[model samples]
Target: MKISAVVVTFNRKKLLLECLNALRNQTYPLDAIFIIDGPSTDGTPEALLECGYIKELPPKKGNWSWETKNVIYSPINNKPIKVYYVRLYKDVGGSGGFYEGVKRAYEEGYNWIWLMDDDAEPREDALEKLIRYMNLPGVIALAPTVIRPTGEISKPHRGILCFKKIFPMIQIPLDESKYKSNQPVQIDFVSFVGPLIKRDAIKIVGFPKKEFFIHHDDVEYSIRLRTVGKIYLIPDSVIIHKENIKKTSLIKKRFLGKTIYRIPYNKLWKTYYGTRNLTYLGRIYSKSKFKFYFKLLKRWAVSVGAIILFDDHKIKRIQFITSAYLDGLRGKFDNEKPKRILYGGKKE
Candidate 1:
């Protein structure tokens, strides 16, 4: 299959290099590699130039979109693989970067697209293992077991949201024994950390909601992808998530085998997107606006309270969340160019 590995990156040039190196050493042959670079002032552009790349595909004529012209090489067993570097005009957040990367891969006639954040580094055989299960019926996307550099398992994020409102995230271990073969286990959701996606599924579900800009975009996209086919976890396919240490919260068990987790909102940016996206999501999945509106107000109120109590810039946090709440409520979206956020530049 024609597989395109799409990596969305920001200002973390060092991390992006580690991620690209891991991908370059993949056991499976990579037909293409795309780096969807958000504008980085941290010498990322200079670093790319220093890496020695050639411009293979020029930007489309009469298009105001991001340019995808540069190329790098990955030599696998004495063969050079082409890698496409796509530089956006500005930082459009992770959502916009992924949307552009995936859309381009789909339009460029790739059969499958491998997705990941630039912070992640996959095992050499990760792509091969993910591809082993892609041909199975009812499987549209396959994800790798993500782990911290310390070898501890990272978050799997297979949560169901409709019934229990905001629930604690449940993570499953990456059991290598279960992956003795190419087994497909169904899941409710998976993060976009390291997943190989079928372009056919993208054709069916459409593009991800880039309006999300950052947090909850994957969760929302997973919900939409579930409509088409099952997303599977390939335990043998692993990736080292070279990410910041994730904070844990109080885990409270609930009825019907559900749990309520007190996951910490990283900062005001997370606070804004999580609450806004939750409010927006409630509107989309809820059968009744009357029912969703009550939940929305409750969540929004809790958001405001949380910001006032925890955030350093409480007032500004509240303002950002309030804008997101209102916009989400009104079903407003303008992803062509995101308005300049007041704080915390752009997120991944």
Candidate 2:
């Protein structure tokens, strides 16, 4: 099988290098590596060319939205692997990068495309093990165990999908007992991080919706893939989620008895996209139109209440989410706004 690895990166140059090195050291041979760089200003492009890890591979093409560069890395099998790097001119988030990378890899005759973020470092045997499950009956896409850098584990592969009580969402528990071996187990959802997906799956269900922008795009894509085939979680296949280790997001007290938290104004952009995308998904997968509208109102009421009670810049949060709700209703999406760093009520 012609295997290609796709990594999407922004300004995280340091971690991006580590991730590329990890990919180069994989036990399974990758035919090519496709990097979708978001035109990072941190000298990421120059760093890739002058990467200290690999030697002497040079760029032989003109720079463009998709610049192709050659990378030389030696595998334990005593062969040099040539990897391809593509830098994107536009910053299209993770979703857009995957859409482009997957499309190109498919067009270039790759049988399988392994998708990952710049911060996801896979174990040596990850690709080898994931490839073992592809030909199994009904297997469509495969992914690895996602562990935090601290070794705290998360199962991106196995998840419960629900659209009944509230919005379209996932319920997850990283139960070790459920994964006793490297045997492939079918799953409801899986993230793009370290997932080895069949090109045929893309041909059938299509690439992820770049319109969702980032969050929930994977879930949305997985949902469509379910219509054609099964997605599997390989127990022994593992990758480290080095980026969001020990990260926390806004959580309402009513959900899990956790204390209500104050959300910063800058983070509201994420809320805008998540709210819009999930509502869009919920509208699509909801049981009925009446149920969808009822849940939508309940969602707004609860969200507005939480913002008023715990968050700062309450009016702006309301405005942002309200705009998101309307946009989602009208099926509109784009790069909303550039993130602005705020400190002590002052924009940086």
Candidate 3:
């Protein structure tokens, strides 16, 4: 099989190198590795060149361009892995990087595309285990169990999206016991971490929505993927996610025996994109307009309450949240507003 891997990276050069090294040592070798650079300013290009990963830096071709380089895996093994380095003019976020990477891999006629971020390093046998399930009946994509460096399962990386009344559209992480015997557990949602997706599936659902910029891009993509075939979580196939855990900025309160997380003022910028994207998804998935708007109103009320009770920068946060909900309802997709709000930069 023509198996290729796609890695999306931003400003983290060290993490990207670790991820690439892990890819280099995979038990089941890959034919190519696509590096989607988010036009990083952290000397990532120079570092890659220093490591002999790429012979030359790719020229900027307008806003987006790519250059291909071939480097032998090692002097002893002498396996060649083609590396395609794609450079963007600006940081369009991981969603845009994956969109570009997947499109290129598909166009190159790769049978399967392994997708991940620069922070994720797969186990040596991860790809081999996933390859074993390629012929499984009606399987379109397979994901490895993602674990933090501390060996705890990363809950958000693999889950089943629940649409029940109690937890509507919430993602429930799979129980470890279910896949403990090395069995593949069927799941409706998986993140971009080490998921091997078949080219045929991409042909049907198309590439990921690039406008998402930062959040919930995987959920939206996974929802579309469910229309084609099953997505499985392989327990034995593991990847270590090395993302630095940030300190929680949200206030947590137990209400009615449920923990409610309230967004803080500083994190409102992120909340905007997440709220907008999720609201957009709800708009697409909800059967009734009344229910959709009702749910949206509840969310807005919660935001207002959070601002009033536990947050600062009250007016600005509310304004951002309100704009998010409204833009989402109107299906207005772009990162211009959020950029202006966060960086005080004008839209291009």
Candidate 4:
């Protein structure tokens, strides 16, 4: 299979470099590597040039609209692998980046596009392992077992429901002896960090909706993809997530500690999007199952309570939660920008 790897990066030049290095060492030869950058001011362009693995895109001067451009590169090896870099002028977040990347993969006629994150470093043979299972029937997307920084594999529980309603779970059994294995399991969702998506899947189900911004975008996309084809969590492939859980300081904990609780940084926005989008998704699938409506109510209640009671930026969180609920109710979803810095507020 001719695979194209698409990586979206923001301000994390260091993490991006680590990700690139890992990609460079992949066992399976990638047809191309596309990097979609979000107009980073952190000298990422220069670093990309220095690494010689990326090509920079032209910069836009004015207007806030997100720009899409691609940079093509070839590996330094004797055979030389082709690579592409795509940079956007505006910060379109994860959903927009992946959408553009998948579109590029489809346009370029690649068989599969490996969607990845800047913070995710795949094992050398990760791509190979994923491709080995891509030939499996009915498989549209293949996700690797993501290992958290704490040395624990972040495997999703089988049969977990979205919107609080029961859904078929894709469970890839965990083998304690080996860090990685390959088995067919049912899953409701999979992270976008390191997933190999077939070109036909994107053409059929379409890319992730850009309205979701960061969180729940993967789940939303997976849910839609599952409608047309199956998504598999390949146990043999592994990606080490370089995410550090921030510890709340004791001093800050004393004042607003009760309001702010510890959650995986990656999941903070997910908590909002999962609740918000699940509500919207429930409406779409409501007629299919009455359970969906009840699940929506449960998610809405949790989201509202979280915003009003636990969220640090209670006002903004409430605004977002309320806006999400209202939008879901009105069935109006298109380019909804979230309020900035949702967890900090002015002191009285």
Cα-based TM-score, every candidate: 0.79, 0.86, 0.90, 0.77
Locate the minimum summed-lDDT window of 10 residues in model 2: 338-347
Q: For model 4, how does the per-residue alpha-carbon lDDT over 120-143 read when each residue is reduced to its tens digit?
A: 899888988888777788888888
Worst 10 residues of 3 by lDDT: 162-171
Candidate 3 per-residue lDDT, tens place, 105-191, comes to 999999999999999999888998899999888899999999999988887778877653211355677776766866788999999
Tell me the tens digit of each residue's lDDT in model 2 across 269-292. Answer: 655678788877776776677988
Score each candidate by Cα lDDT: 0.71, 0.75, 0.83, 0.67
lDDT of 1 by residue, 77-97 (tens): 644566677767665689888
Candidate 1 TM-score over all chains jointly = 0.79
Candidate 1 or 4, higher lDDT?
1
Q: Which regions of candidate 1 fall more than 4 Å away from where they truly are?
A: 53-74, 158-163, 167-182, 246-270, 287-295, 306-317, 334-348
The per-prediction tally of clashing pairs is 1, 0, 0, 11
